[model samples]
Target chain A: MTAIAQQRKPGAEAATTRTRGASSGAAGGGRYATYLLPAAILFIVVIAVPLALNVYTSFTNWTGVGPRQWAGLANYRQLVHDSEFWASMWHSLALVAAMAVIPTVIGLLVAAALFDVIAKRFGPRLASVLRACIYLPQVLPIIVAAIVWGWILDPQYGALNVGLRDAGLGFLAHDLLGDPHTALLTVMAVLVWFQLGYPVVIFMAALQRTDPALTEAAEIDGATWGQRLRLVIVPQIRPEIYVVLLTCTVASLRAFGWIYALTSGGPGEATQVPSYYSYQSFFTNLDVGYGSAIATVMTVIIVAVSVVFLWAQRRHAL
Target chain B: MSAVLTRRRPARGKLARHGLAKHRGPAAWLVLAALAVLTAAVLFPFALIALNAFKPPAQYSAHGPLSFPDGFSTGGVSTFWQTADFGRALWNSVLISGCVCVLAVLLSILNAYALGIGRVKGRTWILGAFLVANFLPQEGLVYPLYDMAKAAGLYDTPLAVIIIFTVIQGAFGTYLLSSVLSTFPPELLEAARMDGAGRARILWRVVVPVSMPTIGVLLVFFFIWTWNEFFLPLVFLVSNSNQTVPVALGTLQGQHIMNPLTTSGAALLGVFPTIIFFLIFQRTLTRGVTVGAVK
Candidate 1:
């Protein structure tokens, strides 16, 4: 809420309150309702119809080309016992750690360092240049990123291996995306590298809004950097932290483009995330019904997570 | 010259903002060095791509991926460029993304104008629903959309992808933009009405012009997100001519994955435009993320 300085009212009333009170009436809704028509059409056709179709298809047996037969809860029943399904579900949590938890942790440290040291001590110009470098990966489509990374990590002639061989560390080189042991870890690292900039950017912005006086007082009181981060900076930007965690968590759960281009759950389904798994079931396995079920389940879980997160965000805002 | 370092209150007298003058020493240099190294690490792959894109495949194979290019070669770039049909892919991407951005922004403004400024009946529920809708993963919608597109005779068309993304991205844009616009100055709207302006005139003349910065931010996001999109494009765009850059490069990642030169060339192609975009919109890009986050 911007301070409505023009307000003649004795105390500050929110701009939002004034806007709402002044603009709204029965005629307002009736008149403006026409503006929503285009979006409503798009929403119904593009989001609503497809979503309803997906859920309904989950209960029926149909290949991509075929007539449907009711499968009832059979797909769900099978998924409950399916180890691969469970494994993919587990992989999502690992991705959340990589994409959300680790990035937020690293981003906080970096954002703080960038804000306190680079922005304040040196200059914001140098700090933002460094921030841009960290954020550079985000501009690439995941496929392009995965392609480059896949090349770098290729077992034989890839950059990492060739460089390693030259450095007399050839023995350490392995098929990073092919071998099961390293595949998921490699994927996670790529995600971390891709996602790190988001939180760094957000938290740094969040820090800008924080009361600099508190930080100044803490430093003058002889508090160490870590102590200042913990007690002063973190709490001040707690809301942004929650937002970052929530968005990144949602992004990780929908993680597909990286898995698709990097591994396709490959070298024997080693890096199979749920999205990729659902893709395989739909296109490769030709199990559209089963795929729909997997998709519906994933959607349900994500909606649940987002609803809870948004609720928490709303409460925290108050 | 730097306000951040220069801002001071003499009445307080004992301190500088961030206490920079007192703390200025080797510590600042150390932080700069650390940040430089981290930035280099993040950018290392891009540096490698630039280094290798100019080398011929055989030269790259022999050079162990570290040596400077042998007097500037374009063999790798031309090879991948021809093979990928990247020109067509680039055109397709531009077309689709441009359509999505404009259509989505228009839809967003209209939707947000109603929900935010008009304060329509049950606007809270509508906003909440839109928020949840924005979070729905593309996976659930893919197969049915695929099926429906076929039925509607729209599969493999750029229009199909454009239409779908317009709605999804527009919904999200609405959710974010509504929050930004809800607090729009009522005085401006009322004043416009006093001039005998109607709803459309007021929205276009009053709301949009005032909210240009936020709308600019949304346009940048829509373009990047649509351009970066892979799944729906890959699924919907089956024809070679219809495929976007990411889909073309992604689908063919297998054939060229082994040849380090061609892969680097492809990476360069896929990456250079983004680099340019980042350079151009660096400020807006950084600020855009926080807009949706904090509010």
Candidate 2:
């Protein structure tokens, strides 16, 4: 800006190093619309048209390449009666419990413990080191983690089973992932391991940024650690708590990489999720219309969830 | 306990040094011990990967997974790498993720300039549309995108994946940057504009430089997210030549070519590059997570 101002190319408004004219061009008045045209065009080309086509395709019957025939909610009616769809829906809710609700609860306690007790009594270095160890897995690609977990939970010659038998708890060992009874439970456990670090990192950072005086004040006022947590720390970080829950829930709701690598929807669809289910239909079954319907329904749920969270956030914080 | 403490002043810092941390002896040790156990539990899988990555298949079968390796071996890693053609996969990942990051950041900056700084008419609706559009999972767009990419003759190229992710990532970036820029000090824009600078000049010379920190965070996120992407790349990059690291590793799993040693080997192959990025950008990544948690 300064360089341009100094060129003085026979135009007006030379650079004046003064504090005047501050308010004139400060609130830029809408000549910026041309700048947005490129992004808007790209967005429409890439996402918007496809999104609309997806919704449209849901109401038609067509394979990947063919003339379309209108099915008009017939796919949706099929969705309602589909047992596997319901099971996948139910499994998605269970994942929300594992990845969002439970993690948030555990993360809050772990974060507070690390912040208040660990950092205070030990040092910031030790606390951050522990935090990093927990956070290390999160930075790895999800497919990698899923692959490693699949190996660990393998039915034969796997570590968990091998270790269990060695400890004379052989009865406790089973085919954790290959068995339908245990597949979803095993998958959910892996997700919890993968998901726990996010809330811990976010919540801990939120705690660090907030005024510590509040927690100290509660502590100095004869409040026990538990009471101080309830009265001071948790309430202080409510906005962060909300943010973590919303993002985690949204991520869990549409989680794909881990499931795709591990179960691929399963030993009898035990671990099927909406994302994987839709993919299977699209490519495996060649039922493009039904797949689009599943995806559209998923979009509706995610948008609804996001809107509710954002509205509540606006009311609470904004 | 002191009048100074109740005033919410610096005296609290003094008391904190000598206060709670000075007490709690056995309890503190117990807490430390528990945290150690928790860290070990969290790291159990990675530990398993490291221990098993070097074991030969014959020894792995003979001794069982729980046994210590006889010695180091690269047989598994080499075999998995050869089978997967990991060199090409790495190159493909680097190209795709890097292009997506650069393009997406520019798109984000431009979109944010209009909505946040220009305060364009109907900006709120535009922003909402972007949010909804991006949040619509890749599943919703996967089939159509596949068809479109095929129609455009981009079915098996890195360019197609690069272009698609740019828009998807850019939409979310626009939403985030708009909020950050809304509070951008208007005085800077005012001074630059008063100098007869055009919008383009001011954006590059002033707005972008000033907002570089947030932009850096956005860049880091875009690279990692694009690199980690699976479902879209799995569908679009059907040929082995264009496959990214995760795609190559993931698609090879059920091909009946894997054994226990190679499973650990494959996991390591997939995770190595990301581990380097995580270490290099450790602090920034942690900081970025909090920034991204905005309402």
Residue-wise lDDT of candidate 2 within A66-170, one digit each (tens)?
698999989999999999999999999999999999889888888888998899888889999989888888888888888888898887878999899889999
- Residue lDDT tens for model 2, B62-106: 777778888889988998999999999999999999999999999
Measured by DockQ, the strongest candidate is: 1
- Please, what are the lDDT tens digits per residue for candidate 1 over residues A1-318? 122554544344465475455647545678887888888877888888989999998998888786888999999999999989988998899999999999999999999999988877777888888888898898888889988888888888778888898899979988889899889999999899999999999998999898776777677668999999999999889899998998899999888889887888876767888999999899999999999999999999999998998889778778
| DockQ-based class of model 1 | medium
* Model 2 docking category: medium
Query: Which pairs clash in model 2?
Result: none
Task: Mark the 10 consecutive residues where model 1 chain B has the least summed lDDT.
Answer: B4-13
Q: Model 2's lDDT to the true fold?
A: 0.86
Whole-model lDDT for model 1 versus the true structure?
0.86
Residue lDDT tens for model 1, B98-172: 999999999999999999888787888888888888889999999988988998999999999999989888988
Candidate 1 stretches with Cα past 4 Å from truth are: A1-23, B1-19, B255-258
